[model samples]
Target: MVDDDDLILEVAQMSLEVVGGWEVTTANGARDGLVRARAEHPDAIVLDVMMPGMDGPTAAQALKADPETADIPIVLLTAKVQSADRDRFADLPVAGVLAKPFDPMRLPAELGSLLGWT
Candidate 1:
């Protein structure tokens, strides 16, 4: 998971680990997220849309452009939920877009469904 907010990261980490029963690695921003995604090669990536220095869509482009990390599915987390706001990211190379202030416990299930996970 990648987000600028420490509280979001902490809560997401716990939710993913405990409730979702998934191994999670978090990055504080898009740059760190790229590095970690390259190194960790996790099953999926959860990215924040409004981060500083390389936002989620840009990061997703970078990930898609790189051969090493190109195959990893990206799910964007954004505070912008309006249709117009969501449409802004429609062209991005991401698996799905999830809203912020999410139900922490349901996050994994929702993400899994998006990715066709059992």
Candidate 2:
């Protein structure tokens, strides 16, 4: 998982670990996320959209562009709720998008559903 916010990363990791029984690794920004993804080859990546430096879609594009991590499904988590905010991601290849302030209790299920992990 990748997000700039420490609290969000902690919450997401805790939620997924407890609720989904999954192991998680986190990155604070997109550049690290991309590098980590390539190295770890995780089952799926849950990325935050508004991160500094490389933003989620750009990172996702980079991951998709690379041969190593190209097939990993990416699910975006964003605070972008407006049509305009959301439309910016329409052209990206993402498994799904989940709104921010997401219920921590529901996050695991959401991730499982979005990535077909369940």
Candidate 3:
């Protein structure tokens, strides 16, 4: 997971781990997320849209550009629920978008559905 907010990171991590029963790792921002993603090679990445240093789409571009990280599925986490903002994300080759303030209990279902994971 990648998000600048500590609370959000913590909540998301717990949601994915506890409710989803999945192994979870976290990065504070986009740059670290890239470095860590390269090293860990997670099956999927949950990235925040607005962050310092590098935003989610920018980081996703870098990941898509690199052969090493290209295959991993990326799901954007965004507060921008407006149709225009959602349309913007649709242009990117991302798996899906999760609205901000997502429900912890529903995270697993949301992620699973997006990645087509049973």
Task: Candidate 3: list runs displaced more than 4 Å.
Answer: none
Question: Which residue runs does candidate 2 get wrong by more than 4 Å?
Answer: none
The best-first sequence of candidates by TM-score reads 3, 1, 2
Best prediction by lDDT: 3
- Give the worst 10-residue stretch by lDDT in candidate 3: 92-101
Q: How would you encode candidate 2's per-residue C-alpha lDDT over 1-118 as one tens digit per residue?
A: 9999999999999998988789999999999998899899999999899988889989999999999999999999999878997787888999999999999889999889888867
- lDDT tens readout by residue for model 1, 1-118: 9999999999999988998999999999999999999998999999999998889899999999999999999999999989998788888889898888999989889888878896
Model 3 residue 70 CA deviation in Å = 0.2
Each prediction's TM-score versus the true structure: 0.97, 0.95, 0.98
The residue pairs that clash in candidate 2, if any, are none
Flag the better candidate by TM-score, 1 or 2.
1
The residue pairs found clashing in candidate 1 are none
Per-model lDDT? 0.92, 0.91, 0.95
Off by over 4 Å in 1: none
Candidate 1: residue 78 lDDT (0-100): 90
Q: Candidate 2 vs. truth: CA RMSD?
A: 0.9
TM-score of model 2 relative to the true fold?
0.95
